[model samples]
Target: MPESPHPPELPARLLADPEMIGACRRRDFALVFRMVKKHAGIYPSMIARRCDLTPSRVGEVMAAKRKLLHMDVVERISDGLRIPGHLLGLSSRAWESPPELSAADWEPPSRPTEPPGAHSLPSHDVGDILASVACTSPRASTVQALRSSIEDYWRRDDQHGGEALRPAVIGQLRYVEILLMQSRGDTVRHGLLGVAAELARLTGWTHFDARQFSQARLYFGEALRFAKDIDDRQFMANVLACMSLQATYQDRPTDALALATAAQDHARAIKGTPRVLSMLSMREAFAHAVLGSRSGAHAAISEAHRQFERISDSDSDPAWVTYFNEYKLTVDTGIAHARLGEAEIAEPLIAQALHREGGTNQRGRAFHTFWLARTQLQQGKLEQACHTAVNALTPASAVASERVTGHLREFSRQLTPHRSEPAAVAYDSRLRQVLPAGVSGPPPP
Candidate 1:
């Protein structure tokens, strides 16, 4: 089949993938084809038609029965499929010639534009930074734009992982750091501090999701410092809560408890919205549950539920804390109960959120699915657990967060004892496809 006039273009994020780059470097077209099919939606037959090969040949190549080492065929795929020639180790393709070439005959080299959402400062930009610091103050509009970008980053992070946006965020954080030092007069600095605090906290979150513990803690501390400098108690409590969450994930439940307790205590002084208090109480509950303090955990959970009941339309929550709602509370409550060895109670709560969650947080859905599966499995419902666990892969497949990946891996480990069951076997077959290469499982022959 000949393709439509417009060929599919992989998103910049997918093209920037390290795995994709490695496959291209190794000339591993079978792997490359699989990745393209997975990410770009260009299947074997379409690939063959686009690259001027027989469908059977493309199938053979994908099945590893054939290889594409010939230069002419490689160039054909590059041009016909719009892959850059350099991606295949060849010289630049004809399409890459300035589109202006045919009409203008010649032209001077133009400034190269960075890929979308990317941020970096070249050596030449240092003077500009200093000049901006020395001359202009950040305007209200500029402050609003920064805040808006922070919100977008949060949404993007929730949908997937931090791999794609981390660079841009870190770049922005550095820029913010510079401004924080240079901007001195007026309420603008306070606003900038709040923004810096959030950006630093966000940067830390990206690292934490990737399992970079030390770096995560460092940024969390940096966030807290920025918050403290301005006496932003609510934001400080938020960062402490984040640190507590990280500690919980790192398996330091006692440390997590200390952090969460401190946050809860500090947040009380603000007597902020019920939503904020509910969130802190939940974080406290999580730590207590992890520490096996059933009484303490239950107490905190009760407080959280009570706070949730008091939430009103006019309640004011800091922008960052607005994501804490009844749905999230329910999910966390269930998870906390699970940690407390109450799977029977946990299962229903988790199942409700798993089915009712309306947001596009694929990673969150995957996390909930894993927890629900684990709870079901704990109750000896082997077949049901396997079915529920397998459903996680669909959502998990779309996100690259190490946290979600860790949940899937833990669920896999839990299923190890039942590996030979037919349901487990079925689940494993699909699971192996998405787990990163060189993970716990061996490479296929």
Candidate 2:
């Protein structure tokens, strides 16, 4: 680890005082800096230079004008002040000598009352005598690594199936939860929770795709709680939209519409970015279509499109919702129309969407192809539907998604009435030879 650029000449008296550690744990940076100024005669500008932050930002934080603590900022402060990471609810700081803790310093202020299995595990000391291990303090780099890991797992879940990455994501969630519990300072605490919320939401999505509805709901709820705590309306609305989507998939149109509406209402109340508004409106369209409200659905979809049009790629947006685009809107519009039984309208829209972007998303291609096939079948184009369904199988087979399999199963059911037809016969034969088991096909290869 690199040495601090501006190590404070902290006196032994100040270092030994429990109040200083208590202030750190409480995230009283202003007080902490005041103490530094009093003892070491260092000014905030000097501190800012040492911490690699702009003087204005440091001044804002000290004056309590800025309360949002980011992980990078926390690392700078910890490194500069020579504070142990654990003192501020962080893991052990790798750069500095571990702070000496008396027995009184080791105990937490208080423990929350909770039933067995409901409480968090005890916090581990950096060098616990019982554990005989040295834990490094959490670094800004560590948070960045975790964010990258989550993104990789997300991409893996897209290409592969949730089952392949489920255990690992769950483990990551637990690890993040531990970090949230242990992290002290505002910057690190908020940053860890923000990342953890995203992880929870991703875990919930994987579970939902895997048909683990109960587990999916649990994680979504966790994500929502964290988002709420952080006052992140966009993330909170996003989670609600996910829940709405799950409800729509389960055929609970009323619940889906309610959730989506709640999301939209909250987004508006927060004056969220156009991208956020667009996402919520799109979700509302899905629910409206599911409920057989064609005009309402179309209106919501149009609003979504308008909101999306207002957003430019260069505009500042949250990382999670950056995937939204014109092509996605087209695909969603097609889905909404399909749900409303407008096959003719849906077919062209879906075809256009696939033509433009199908090559990029294997899972999405499988999903859209299944829908296109369904729409063809709805239009009585049995031969064309069979071909489309066949095109879907390869990507569907490559992924481990229960939702994709469900689509294939529904397609099979629609094919049953036409089974005696030559095209249907060929499809069945091909499906039986190629598709995974329990969906009227051979087991996955």
- Return the top candidate by lDDT: 1
CA RMSD of each candidate after superposition: 16.4, 24.1
Stretches off by above 4 angstroms in model 1 are: 1-135, 440-445
Candidate 2 deviates by what RMSD?
24.1
Q: What does candidate 2 score on TM?
A: 0.69
lDDT of 2 at 242: 97
Q: What would the per-residue lDDT of candidate 2 be over residues 1-445, giving only the tens digit for each residue?
A: 6545547546878866788867776667887887887887768987777766667766877887754243335656777777777665455665654356445457767645342121232233321332332123555666788899988887787788778786666666667666665676788777777887888888789989987777788788888878887888878889999999998776557888999998888888877788888888889999999777989999998999999888966767878887777788898889999988999999999989888984335678899988999999999999999998888888887888878876776677567668789988888777767775456532211
Model 2 spans with C-alpha error above 4 angstroms: 1-136, 358-360, 441-445
Q: What is the C-alpha lDDT of each candidate?
A: 0.79, 0.76
* Candidate 1 residue pairs in clash (backbone atoms < 3 Å): none
* lDDT, residue 387, candidate 1: 94
For model 2, state the Cα shift of residue 201 in Å.
Answer: 1.0
Local lDDT at 394 for model 2: 84
